[model samples]
Target: MTHHTDLLIIGAGILGLSHAYAAAKRGLKVKVFERTATPLGASVRNFGQALVTGQPPGPMLDLARQSRDIWGQWAQLANLQLKRNGSYLFARTEAEEHLLEAFCAGRAEEYGYRVNLLQGAAMNDLYGGQFRHHRAALHGLDDQQLYSREALPALINYLCRELKVEFHFSTLVRDIEPGQLHSTAGSFRGEQIIVCSGHDYQTLLAEQIAELNPQICHLQMLRARPKVDLNLQHALLTGLSCVHYGAFADLPEAAPVQAQILRDVPHLHEHGIHLLISPTPYGELIIGDSHHYGSDPSPFNAEQVDNWMIELAEQTLGCQIQVVERWQGVYGSRGPGPFSFLRAADGVSVALMHTGVGMSVGPAMAERNITELWGEV
Candidate 1:
């Protein structure tokens, strides 16, 4: 069978869905093909936090801001659950605190949101989350989160049912031509095609993107049930996160913070581990993760990494956690870029987020790409 659409999107991950959304909003007939029955890639494998605050300035940050608005629109349109309640980045040391101080004092407002500077233990007093070593905290007011496991599917359904988008799940694209692509399910034709197949660059546009030498960034994610009611309203991150996110990495104070963390925790940078804890509406906690990158990512999920994360979460929250679930999350990374976008032969384009910020920036990127390809409606 042959399917024809105004726009054809490969991969049903966040990027693909975002493209579908942007195209459909332009009144184009859009069809999406996914290798898996559902989006099982970086889209759902993450903490579901938007992390707009973590984006560096320029194009990446601009895209994040635009995507945040789109996410809000989708939440209401699709009746999806979204926690508009921001996020928290805490300092475990004086250096980390100084970084947050300088960041807040300088240009955090340019992020298009308010960032409240909180003293070490003040978070516990206001939000009931106890971080034992907190020196200061940046309460980023714009970051949002969705329980992507549920919200993403709901968004797909809304796209199909309400916006008239078509989706072919479990369809593997075998070949790409000028205006068409052949999939396991059938042949699909579109005026424009977008290949956002997460981490499967070799299968699509190897020549255009392979030279960049992107690797699979392997990560460990966990869901735990806290022993007590923490009443934490905001998503949480630690000093490791401050240094890890590009937003603060450029701050003069960030170098010392990173150095201090490396000196204190020898295993952290070794394993690319950072601490992020967020709550699920159902009362479970989302905790994670450790990073390791390679052409072929490790099949082994380190037990020590999971143990370390749980320990860190416990210390930060001042409560024990019973881990209910665990898994390995993987995404394509090109070392030091936010993402790589390239055009290929025959109206085909490739967009892959090198960082896990795809969920936060994909929609805006899609909108921009679609406009550049076909011009705005």
Candidate 2:
């Protein structure tokens, strides 16, 4: 049977769901298709950090802030367990610390986001007194983190019950042409088509669409059960992971990058790590992240990264951690620009560039762009 709707969204990940919610809210009949029985893509695979601290100043940063506000509002309306752990980024070295201070100085007032520089006893006291090894660090107050594992299920349930969006799971789309998409189940046609396919861009769009050289980075992260209460209530980041998040890996002078990693985030860089510890209302901690960038990297989940994260957790929060869960995530790779919205043709748009922070800006992006295209919603 052919499924006809006003709008058809391919790839029911965070991006797809965003479109579903936005379109439906605008009174557009929407149908979303997911290739997996469950959302196994980066949308649900991430730590669910609606990141705002690391976004560089400009439109991307503005979009992130807007999306973040929407996430909080939606979660509250939907009654989901969302954690508003303000995010922090710090420099562990002198040079790195200076750079962060410079960054904070310029945009501190514009966004009304506070970025504080702490040191000596002040720094120690602020960060649990365990990470006294840092020279300087920047903290951003007001941003929050989401548990993707929980948010996806909650959002999907809410959308189905309230918005009347149709979701077809375990349905792989074999082809997407001008006005139709072919799936294993049947054909889906709509007035407008938005391709939300993440890393699978190659399959749906041809070389012309993908010539932007969209790639992906594979990462390994683990979830651990803490032996003791961390008493930590923020998304913690250090120089090592912050540098990558700051999108400055390929800087001409590599020394500044090193200084930034070690000086700004000594605690994290010394161990090559950063952690997003959201003490699940259930008492477990979600600690992660080690990065490997490539179009298609080798299988990268390492017991070593897990061990390293656990050890860092112990050091940062002064508590022992037990390994309870482990996993890997694939995020869109860096490209010429921050994000891309290629209007391949009238009524056919391709949304790309989650930048590992899609959760931060997905909904607003969907609502604004789709509404502009459709002219009513």
Candidate 3:
């Protein structure tokens, strides 16, 4: 069978779905193709943290703020559960505390967000005694969270049912040209084509993606089901995250924090380990992650790295967590750039390597890309 649409999107991850939603909302006929039966990529495997507070200043941060707003609107419309649980970057050492103080004092506004610096009694009053041992914490009051496992499907449902966007699943795209895409299901013809395929350098525009020599980042993540019900009010991050996130890294104060981390926790740094613990609506804790980068990262999950992650989480939260699930996620990355965009051909754009911020900035980035491709719509 043959199909036609005003816009054809390849890949059904958040990026592709965002493009479909944006185009369809503008009254363009949109069709999406997914090689898998469902979204099984980084879009579904992430923490689903729509984090704007951690984005570096400038275009990336702007896009994240916009995307966060869009996610809230869609969540209400679709009746999806969106958790507006803020984030806290807590510091354990005096050096880490200095870094947080500097960030809250100087760089917070530059990063285009407000954060409260909590310590001692104030921290205990807000987050309870669990955080009392920590020297200081930066509270980002506007960060949001959603269960990607559920939210992605809800977004797809909303797009299809309300916007009439077409979706073809388990359809492998064999090739893509300027105006048409050849797929296992059928050939699709559209005026514009947007490819949001992540870490899939072999399919579609293999030659172009190869030319870029993009690095693939593999991360190990785990889910812990606490034996007791614990309602967490905020997504907790450790001082390690301050060094990992670009917004904090760009700050001058982050240098000493990074140096301290490298000197003190060299093993954690070796594995790109940072602690992020987010609580799900069901009372389970989703924790992660360690980063290993290469063209092909080892499929073996490092038990040692997982242990380190859990230890850090336990120390920071001061609680015992039972591991219930474990997994790995691989995504495309090009250092420094929040994302990479390639012009495969006229009327065709390839968006990939969104690093760890796909859920944070995907929607607004897609909207901007579509507007750039078609102009003034």
Candidate 4:
């Protein structure tokens, strides 16, 4: 059998869907194939928080801001459920507090978002005694969170209904056979192809692109159901605790500095501890996670890590939350910045990543790259 599409996208994760939506919006014939029965990869298996604050300055932050807007527009268009819950980063120690102050003061211009400085009784009053150890907190007005699990499925439905994106689920591609795709379902030929494989990089292409410089990390995330009514409206992050939050402390040749920062920031842990205390519209609070890094992620779930996260959440939220669900999300870290846009010999090029932030950056990156490639939109 033979089928032709103007744009063929592999991997129906968020990135693939973003690209497909962009191309279809441009009126291009687009088709997407995914190895899974449902589009459940890192995209759905995340905190679903469209984080805008705490990102370092530069193009990455710009892309994050842009993606947030796109997500908003798409949510409205698709009538998807989006929680505009704002986010807060708390500093537990004097040094951590200072760092938060510096962060709020430093990146205001570039990020175009105001990081409100909350300290002393104000911090304690708003967040309760849970953050009593901290001297300050960085609260961003424009920084909002999302429920990606709901968002992705809704986005997929919108793509099909409005943009006419053809999605082939459970159709695993065995090979990119020249100008054609050999899949479990059948064969598909296209004028152009875009491979959007996330961590399964080796499955899509023959050679590793230098720009990809992808690093893989395995993270554990938990969803919690509180015993009582929880009225948390904002996403929360602890200073000096989560690896992603205190990552700057571990820069190359900066162990001493990292140690000093950790010392000053008592909550900082080397294993990386960040929590998303956002209550879903359904009344479940999602908290997570700890990080484990390697070229290949080990198939192991550490109970100690889960315990540590639960302890952290119980202390922060002032409630003994019940862990209803837990899962692992593998992300491609240390990439050539954002995602890789590759053009292969078969005229099939695509973007790939291993994390959810790819959703936060998808629209701008997809629009820019797809326009450059197909010369249509």
Among these predictions, the greatest TM-score belongs to 3
TM-score, cand. 4 vs. native = 0.89
Q: Where does candidate 3 stray beyond 4 Å?
A: none
What is the per-residue lDDT of model 2 for residues 1-377, given as tens digits with 9 covering 90 to 100?
67678998988888888888888888889988888887888887787777776665667677788888888877976677776757666565565665666555655566555567676777788746665767765766656777777788888888888988888899988887767889987998888888888877567776645678867777767777767666556677665554565522333333686765566546556433565555555667777776666677567466766777777667655568887878777877676676677878766788887377788777778877777777664
Scored by lDDT, model 1 comes in at 0.85
Local accuracy of candidate 3 as per-residue lDDT tens digits, 279-354: 8778888899999988876789989999998888788777788999999977888743778778989878888854
lDDT of 4: 0.72
Task: Provide C-alpha RMSD values for all models, in order.
Answer: 1.6, 3.5, 1.4, 3.2
Better candidate by lDDT, 1 or 4: 1
lDDT agreement with native, every candidate: 0.85, 0.72, 0.85, 0.72
Question: Considering summed lDDT, which 10 consecutive residues are worst modelled in model 4?
Answer: 245-254
| Cα lDDT over the full model 2 | 0.72
Candidate 1 residue-wise lDDT, 174-256, digit = tens:
88887999988878888888889888867877777777778899899999998988766678998888778888898898889
Candidate 2 off by > 4 Å: 118-137, 247-257, 260-276
Name the runs in model 1 displaced over 4 angstroms.
109-113
* Reference-based TM-score of each model: 0.96, 0.87, 0.97, 0.89
